[model samples]
Target: MFDESVSKKIHVPLVLSMFIGLLTILINFFYSVEDIRSEVYSSQSKELRAAYVNGLREKKVIALTNVINLSSNYSIIESLKSQDRNVAIAGLQTLSRKFKEQTIYKNIKVHLHDANLRSFLRTWDVEKYGEELAGFRKTLRDVKKNKKAIATIELGRAGLLVRGIAPIENDGVYLGSVEFMQGFNSIVKNLRKNREYETAFLMKEDYLSVATALSSSPKIKEFVLAVKEKNVDKDFLNSLKGVEIEDTKNFQISDEYFLVSEPIKDFSNVIVGYALIGEKTSMVETVIAKAKSSLLKQVYIIFFIDIIILIYLIIIVRKKIIRPIVDMEKMAQELSL
Candidate 1:
C-alpha cells in the first residue's frame, strides 16, 4: 500500500509537467501554421501580378492590330485623299456598326488628324471636331512625324485609353494620322472572369478633370473607382476607402482576404492609377485547419503512449531496485541496535 501510494505521488508531478509541455507545443504549432499561410500567399501574389501584366500586354497588341487594319480600309483612304467630311463620316458610321457586330471591339472610336496634328474628325462625336490637338496629342504627332504607326496607353480628355495611331500616306505624301482608341473595361472584365481575381482600377484625383470616363463611377477617398474597376460586392468596394498603392506590395482587408495593388502608368512613365487585385483565403484556411487538426491528433496519441510507458518503467525500478535498497537499510538499523 505504501509503495503504491509513493508511485501515485510521483505520477502527479510528472503528469503536470507533461501537461505544461503539451501546452507549449500547441503554441509553437499554431505559430508555424501561420508562417506556412504567409509563405503560400506570398508565392501566389507573384503569379497574380504576372497574369495581370500579361493580360494588359495582350490587350495592347490586340488594340494596335485592329487600328492598323482599319487604317487600310479603301473608303477611309479615299475620304482622307479628297478631304471629304460627309463621305468620311458615312464610311466610319458603317465601319463602326460592322465593328460592333463582328468583333469584341464594340464602340471603337476612330479619330482623324490632319498633317499638322489638328483633330479633323471624331467618329464617336461628329459635332466635337476642329479642336487643335498639337499640345497633348503626342501619339498622333509621333505617327505623323515618323511616318509610321505607334500605339500606347495614353490619358486624354476622354480618359485613359489604349490608343493606336497609324500614318496615312498617299503616293509618298503623308496626309494625316488615324487614331483608334478603346477603354480598359473589357480587360478588367476578362481578368475577373478568367483568373477569379477581383480587380479595381483606382484613378488619381488629378486625372478626374481629364479622364471623363472615371468621373461618374464611384469615389473612394481621393481616387476614383474607374469604369474599368470590378468588385463582387459594394461593401467590399466601400472597404477600400484608404487603400494606398505606393510602397505597399500586398495588404489584408480581413482575416480571409488578401489584396495586392500595382501602379498603372501612362506612356510618359507617369503614375496614372493602380490596379488592385484581391482574392479570398478559403484554400489557405482549409490547409491550415487540416494541418492543425492532424498535429493535435498525433501529439495527443504519442504523449498518451509515452506517459503509459514512463509509468510502467518507474514501477519496475521500484520493484526491482528501490525496494531492495530500502529493505537493506532497515536491516542494518536493526543490526546496529
Candidate 2:
C-alpha cells in the first residue's frame, strides 16, 4: 500500500512536468517574435530619418540655385556694373523690395565689384541690421577662388544670417557678387513649425551655433563651443576637406542619439555647409515605452489562454492516465495483502 501511494505521487509530477515543458516552449517563441519586431522597427526608423534629412538638403539647394539665377539676370548685372552707385543701389533696392514681398526671404543686399574684384558699390540696410560688408567681402573671395556658388551660416553684428554668394558677370567680365540673406531664425522656426523633429544648420568649421530648434540646454551650448573649437583643429578639418557627406552615425551629445548629417552643396556641387538631424534619446524612450505596453498586453492575453489550456489538459491527464495507474496499483496492493 505504501509503495502504491509513492508511485501515484511520482506519476502526478510526470504529468505536471509535461505541461511545464510546453509553457517553456511558448515563452521562448514569444521572446523570439519580440526580438525580431524590435529589429525591424529600429531599421525602419533609421531609414525614415535619413530620407527626411536628404530631402531637406535637396530643397535648400534648389531654393539657393533659384535665388542665384534670379540675381544673375542680365539687367541686374548691367545695373550694378554702371558707374553711378545711386543707380545700382536704387535698382537693387527695387528688386529686393519685390523679392521680400513675393518670396519668403526678408532681405537681399547687392555688392558690386570692379573689374579687379574689389568692392566698390554696396547697398544694405545697416540700420535695422548692422553692416556685414567685411564678411561679405570674404565670401566674395571664396566664390572667386572656388568659381562656384558659396553658402554660409554666419553670425554677424546682425543677429544671424544664411548668406548665399553668387558671382555676377557682365559681358564675360566678372563684375561683383550678389549676397542674399534669409534670417536664420525664420528658417529654423519655419522648419520646426512644419515638422516634429529637431534640426540644426552648421557652417563649415564654425563652432558657433548657427540655428537650432532646441529651446535651451546647457549641454547644447557646450556642444556648440566644442564644435567651434574642433573646427579650428587643423587636423580634423583637413580630414573632412574632400569629403562631401558623412554617413549616418549614432552620436551621443549628452545621451545617445540617432544622427544623420549631409553636406549642403551649392549650384556647382561644392560642399559649402552641413545639415545635421538628430532624434533625441527621449524620442526612442517613448517608442520603447509604447512597444512595451503593446507587447505586455499581447503577452498577457497569450498567458491567459495558456493557463486555460493548461488547466484543461491537467484535468484530462489526471483522469485518463494518472487515475487508471492509481487504480491498478490499488488492485495489486489488495491482492498482495
Candidate 3:
C-alpha cells in the first residue's frame, strides 16, 4: 500500500509540473510576440512621419524662396510701375518665360497682383484672371499689411492650392504682391518622383475630402477621389483634428496598410489640412512572422529537452528508490519463510 501510494504521488506531481511549465512558457512567448509587434509598429510610424516632415520642409523652402526671388525681380517691379497695359503684359510674359527656362520652375504657376489686390497677370490666362483676387482677400491683406512673405494651403476656386505671396517693392513703396501657386497635382507628381510611396492630401470642409492622391497605378487617383466624395473612412475624418502620427490597425480600406498623418499649418500655425502617407504592411508582417517562427522553434526545442529530463528523473527514482524498497520487502518475506 505504501509503495502504491508513493508511486501515485510521484507520477501525479511530475505530470502536473511538466504541464505547468509548458503553460508558463506559452504565456511568456505570447507576451513577447505582442511586445515585438508593438515595437515594430511604433518604429515604422516614426520613420514615416519623419520622412513626411522632411519632405514638407523642403517644399516650403522651395515655394517661399521662389516667391521671394520673383517678388524682387526687376521685370516684375518695372511692369508694375509701367503706365501702358501692353508694356506690363509684355514684361510679365517675358518674366514668365524666363522662369520656364529653369527645369524646376517649368510647371509652376505665377500670378502678379496689383496694389489693390487685383490680379493683373497670370501664367495660365492673364485675360480671364485679370480681376480682383476674390477668394484670397484675407491672405492678400495679411501680406500687404505685414509686408512679409506668407505661405498657406487653401482650397481655391480651381482646386487645392499651396500659394506663397511676397510683397513687391521698388523704393520702399509696396507696389503689389507676387503670388506663386503650386497645385496639388504638381505637388503629388513631384512627391512621387522623390519617394515611391502612396500619398494623399486631405482638406476638411463640411467633410474631409481627398484633394489629391496617387497610388501604385495612375488610375488610383480616381479611386481616392471617389472615396473622398463618398466620405468612406469616418475614422480618418475624426483623426484629422490633431496631428496624429501612428500606424493604422486593420485599415477600413484594406489590411495591408500603415498610415501616417501630419498636419499642414498656415503662416499662423493653424491646421489647414493633412498629409497622409500609406505604406504596404507586407514589410512589417513578414518581419513579425519570421520572429514568431523562430521563437516557436526555440520553444519546441525546450519542450523536447524537458521531456528527456523528466524521463531521466523517473528512471533514477525507480532505480535508487522504488526498486530498493521492493527488494527489502522481498528479503524480509523470505527470512520469515
Q: Which structure among the candidates has the greatest lDDT?
A: 1
Using lDDT, rank the candidates from best to worst.
Answer: 1, 3, 2
The predictions' CA RMSDs to the true structure, in order, are 5.5, 9.1, 7.4
Candidate 1 or 3, higher lDDT? 1
lDDT of 2 by residue, 1-337 (tens): 6545654576567657756866776687678667855664565457546655555555457446754874566555776577445565666677778879998656555445544555555556422322334444556677666656766644443323456667776666676666655543343344445544444544443323333422231122123211223223233222232223344343322234444555554443555455554455466567666666676676678777766776787677677866787788789989999
Clashes of each: 0, 1, 0
- Write one digit per residue (lDDT tens) for candidate 1, span 1-337: 5455665676566667777876777787778777766766776677668877887788788767877887787767777788877777988888989989998867878998877777778987888777889888667766777787776888877667778888888888887888888777776677768876667767788888887766787777777776544443454465566455553567555444556777888877788887776666675566567766877787778778767876786777678756876677678889999
Best by TM-score: 1
Which whole-number lDDT from 0 to 100 does residue 329 have in model 2? 79
lDDT of 2: 0.53
Model 1, global lDDT: 0.74
Please list the C-alpha lDDT of all candidates, in the order they appear.
0.74, 0.53, 0.66
**2 or 3, greater by TM-score:** 3
Q: Give the per-residue lDDT of model 3 (tens digit) for 7-33.
A: 678777987899899889989999989
What is the Å distance of residue 88 in model 1 from its true position? 2.7
Could you tell me every candidate's TM-score relative to the true structure? Answer: 0.73, 0.57, 0.64
